[model samples]
Target chain A: MENFAALIYVISSVLFILALRGLSHPETARQGLNFGIAGMALAIFTTLLLPNVGGYFWIVIAIALGGGIGTVIANKIEMTALPQLMAAFHSLVGLSAVFVAAAAFHNPESFGIGTQDDIHLVSLIEMSIGLAIGAITFTGSLIAWGKLQGTISGKPVTFGGQHALNAALGVLLILLIIILCAGESAVIFWMIALLALSLGVLMIIPIGGADMPVIVSMLNSYSGWAAAGIGFTLHNNLLIITGALVGASGAILS
Target chain B: MSAVLIMAGGAAVSPLVFQLAIFVMAIFVGYYVVWSVTPALHTPLMAVTNAISSVIIVGAVIALGAADASGFSKFLAFLGVTLASVNIFGGFIITRRMLHMFKKKD
Candidate 1:
């Protein structure tokens, strides 16, 4: 069963890659979307069949509610508002990364990482980095969405020592990660998450609204990296591949 | 130090190393593939990528499926599922809409 699931994942990964390749020309872009949808469906189906997965009642409810909301918003939103919508969607991905990371942290054995007291060193590092990146992406994308929506000022918000403050925070974030890795402390983990959330807001507010497209794309990249980091924790290859693909795509587009 | 470096290099390769190799290569693939996309299709590209990135939902599904998931873990996973579902549906629909607009002119 595991082998079969792995085989399906490999095929789905290929389909995803092809889906991206199809985007090279408008003639095949829709075809690419179809490939992407099929790949996603296959990946999800196979994951559901994994030995580790159990109940599905709540899962169904969650997907139904989310899908309904997404469809309505997509249909009603003005094309002019697509950038902000993109920001909104990126924020969702970011938040999902954080949630999944937290879930895994809370139940390491369920994730096939070791138990709470003996989680693999690599897994610990992966979880911490994933949580941090996810937090940053979540808040950064939110601020970007607000700016694009005109709810926040379009003008650059600058302050004296802004770079210094950001620099200090960055260093502190790294220090916290190191501490978390060395000691495997949950407090340090949450601390990194909170600091990253703040850093995301601080990092984006300084840029003017005109630069929001770039910021949106950059956040898109961060979302992908966040996903990839969590993938490392789960030892999931498809996540790593798809995340890298999105990360690279966002970087290039930005 | 040199001996330690050499020994490390010669040690049996871990699965993480293999996954890292795949990750790095996929980045190159994405770089080339995305660059070939025409300027006119950038918005659709962003939308489509948004759909694909929701692949993270697989992680949520696994979390939800876990037999021993606590209420807190389940809640987190449930939120992950809901949020990712929004991206998957909204992203694809909007991308298709944008692409259709382009096709009308062509």
Candidate 2:
């Protein structure tokens, strides 16, 4: 059964790769849409075949509600607002990663990692990466969305010692990470997460309005990394592969 | 130190090395292929990437489907799944709508 699921995942992954290739050309691009949807459909179905699935009441509710909202918004949105819409979507991806990270931390035993005392340093690092990157992406994308929406100033906001502040925060985040890796401390973990979120806010606020497209792609890449981090935490190879594929490609596109 | 000794000292480098290899390969593939995309197709190309990245839904689905998921975990997973649904649905439909306009005969 596991092997069957793995086989489906492999085929789905290949289709995803092909779908990406098709996206690269104008003629093949529209034709490629079916492949992507088919790939996603197979992937979702494959997950349902897993032995340990619980009651899916919540999942079903989420899909219906989100699908309804998404369809309405997508059909109504103007082309001029696509950039912001994309940014807002990236924020969703980012927030999704954050939620996944929180879920993992909430219950390590279910993931087959270890008891509360036996957490591996590697997993801790992975979790922290998920936590920090997810938080950063969430807030960063929000700020980008805000800038695009004119709720936030589009001009580059500068102040005295801004670069210095970023540098300080960057260094402090690293220190906190090192400490967290050396030992299990929830307080320090949340602290690092907060700092990372702040870093995201600061990183985008200084970029001018003309560069929002670049920021959009950058956020896209960040969202991928956030997913990759969650993949590491969950010990899911497919997530790592898919997330890395998105992250690297998005970086190149940016 | 020899390679063996160095690996023994490393806590989690192998997974990273493998992951990095995949990342590099994807980057190269994307770089050439995406660049080859004529500027005429940039919008649709962007549309696809946006749609594909929301595969984060996979994680949320798995999380919410876990047998032992607690209340908090389920809630978060539900939120993740919901938002990711928004991304995929909005992204693909919008892409299709835009592409429809291009498909019409003059």
Candidate 3:
């Protein structure tokens, strides 16, 4: 069953690659979107069939709720709000990454990582980085969304010692990561999440309206890497491949 | 040192190593393919990629499916699913709308 699932995942990955390839030309872009939809559908179906999967009652409900809201928003949003919508979507991806990392950290063995008291060192590192990146992406995208929506000022917001503060936070985060490696502590984990969230806001606020598009794309890339970091923890190849593809796409566009 | 070299050269590479290799290669593939996209389609490209990136939903589903998931973990997983679903559905719908607009012009 595992092998069969892996085979299906492989086919889905190929379809995704073809989807991006198809997007290279205007004539084939719509076809590319179809391929992407097909790939996602196949991936979700295969995952549902995995041996470890449990009941689907809540999962169905969640999808319906979110899907219904998403459809309404997509149909109603103005074209002028495309950037804002992109930022909003990117923020959700980031938040989802953080949530998944937290879930895995709470139950490592179920994720095939390790037990709570003695999680694998590599897995721990991956989770920490994932959590950090996810937090950063989440808040950063939110700020970007606000800027695009004109809720936040479009001017570059800079204060005294901005770079120094950002650097200090960066060093502190690294220190926390090292401490986390020495011992697994939930407090430290949550602290990392909080600090990263602050750092995300600090990092984005300094950029002005003119550079918002670049920042948006950069956050898109960060979201991809956040997903990839969690992918490492989950040991899922499809996530890793898709994350890398998205990351690289955003990098090139930015 | 020689032993380390021999191990590195051996066929018994770890799964993580294989995953890293695939990850790196996929980046190159993405770089090339994304570069070829026309500027006219940039918005739609971003929209479609946004949709595809929600493939992270698989991870959320795994969390939801775990037998031993706690209430807190389950709640988090549920939120993850909802958020990703929004991206997947909203992203595709918007991209299709934009593409349709482009088609109408041609």
Which predicted model would earn the best TM-score? 3
Q: What is the lDDT of residue A108 in candidate 2?
A: 68
Per-residue error (Å), model 2, residue A1: 3.1
Q: Which candidate would rank higher by DockQ, 1 or 3?
A: 1
Query: How does each model score on TM-score?
Result: 0.95, 0.90, 0.96
The CAPRI-style docking tier of model 2 reads medium
lDDT for predicted candidate 3 compared with the true structure = 0.88
Query: Could you list the CA RMSD of all candidates, in the order they appear?
Result: 3.5, 3.9, 2.9
Candidate 1, residues A1-254, lDDT tens digits: the string is 87898889888888888888787688898899899989999998999889888788988898899999999999999999999999999999988998998888877878899887678889988888888888899999899999999999988999999999999999999899888778877788778889999998999998889999999999998888888998899999889989999999989889
Cα lDDT of model 2 by residue, A134-202, tens digit: 888888989899999888989999899999999999999888989987776767877887898899899
Q: Over 4 Å off in model 2, which ranges?
A: B1-23, B104-106
TM-score of 2: 0.90
Estimate how well candidate 3 is docked, as a DockQ score: 0.73
Per-residue lDDT for A85 in model 3? 91
List clashing residue pairs in candidate 1: A54-B65
User: Candidate 2's residue-wise lDDT over B1-106, tens digit each?
Assistant: 2544666677877755655555555556555656566665666666666777777787788778887778887888889889988888887888787677667732
State the weakest 10-residue window (summed lDDT) of model 3 chain B: B1-10
